[model samples]
Target: MTRALLLVDIQLDYFPGGAFPLAEPEAAAVAARTVLDSFRESGELVVHIFHVATAPDATFFVPETPGIGFHPAVAPLDGETTLEKHQPNSFIDTGLETVLREAGVTELVIVGMMSSMCIDSTTRAAHELGFVCTVVSDACAAPDLTLGETTVPGASVHAAFMAALDGSFATVTPSASLV
Candidate 1:
């Protein structure tokens, strides 16, 4: 089956000194770069999904902001496909499914920021769309979240989301396994 690497929301907003920094952003970016380099060397299809927040009150990834740009580590090459999305699911109104189908991509390797949100939504959507998905856990990061009076750790949130995706929506693996 044909395979493609889908890098989602690997933008500056998730890195340190950006609008919404996540836990271990540098480490995740490095891991993502490893897989991205592997794909490039192998001449495999690579698509980048960038979240462009349209909500006026959105704090990060606002249009025309520097944070909306891709992180250097996982930036898309000139000829690579780039999809700008406004929702958690990359396929939602982004024509991602059509692009994957046109490219004959039956399998996807997903890695990116905000594992609990974008990763979760995209993986589930891809599964429902009949594409086999593999999520690289180490190449994804999540920020801490607050639920009512409780604060959840970023690492724990990431792990929980990975666990939820594994064996169901997608196969959760580390970058080493793919690289």
Candidate 2:
């Protein structure tokens, strides 16, 4: 079966010095780039999924702002497919499924930002859509802001999300071994 790497929302707005920078953004991007480069060498499909905010004047991820662009470290090549979405789930209101189907992708190896939100949503959706999913743990990161004042730690939140997805929605693995 053919497999593809579905990188989600690795944009400027999600990195250090951006609007919603996550903890350990640089590490996550590096890990993702390493994994993607290896996959590209192997001739696997690499689709970069980016979120374009549908706001009028929002600086962070607005189409007009540079913050909406993909992060420099994880920039996709000319041959790679770029899927843009407004929702957290890449497949939602996007042609992601069609693109994957056209490329004969029966499985997906997912990696990217916001492990608890976009990562989680896409992983579960892809699994339900009948693709075998593998989530690159180190290549994904998240910040805990669910609880208002008594906020949880980002690392703890990332771990919990991975644990929840490990055996059910997807197989959680490190980027190093996957390539």
Which candidate number maximizes TM-score? 1
Query: lDDT per residue, candidate 1, 13-56, as tens digits?
Result: 89889999999999999999999999999999999999999999
Which runs of model 1 end up more than 4 angstroms from their true locations? none
What does the lDDT read for residue 152 in candidate 2?
81
lDDT of 2 by residue, 1-179 (tens): 99999889999988877888887878989999998888888999999999888877665687767788898888989988998898888999889999999988999999998999999999999999999999999999997566666888788889999999999999999987887
- lDDT over C-alpha atoms for residue 45 of model 2: 94
Output the TM-score of candidate 2. Answer: 0.95
The Cα local distance difference test for each model comes to 0.95, 0.90
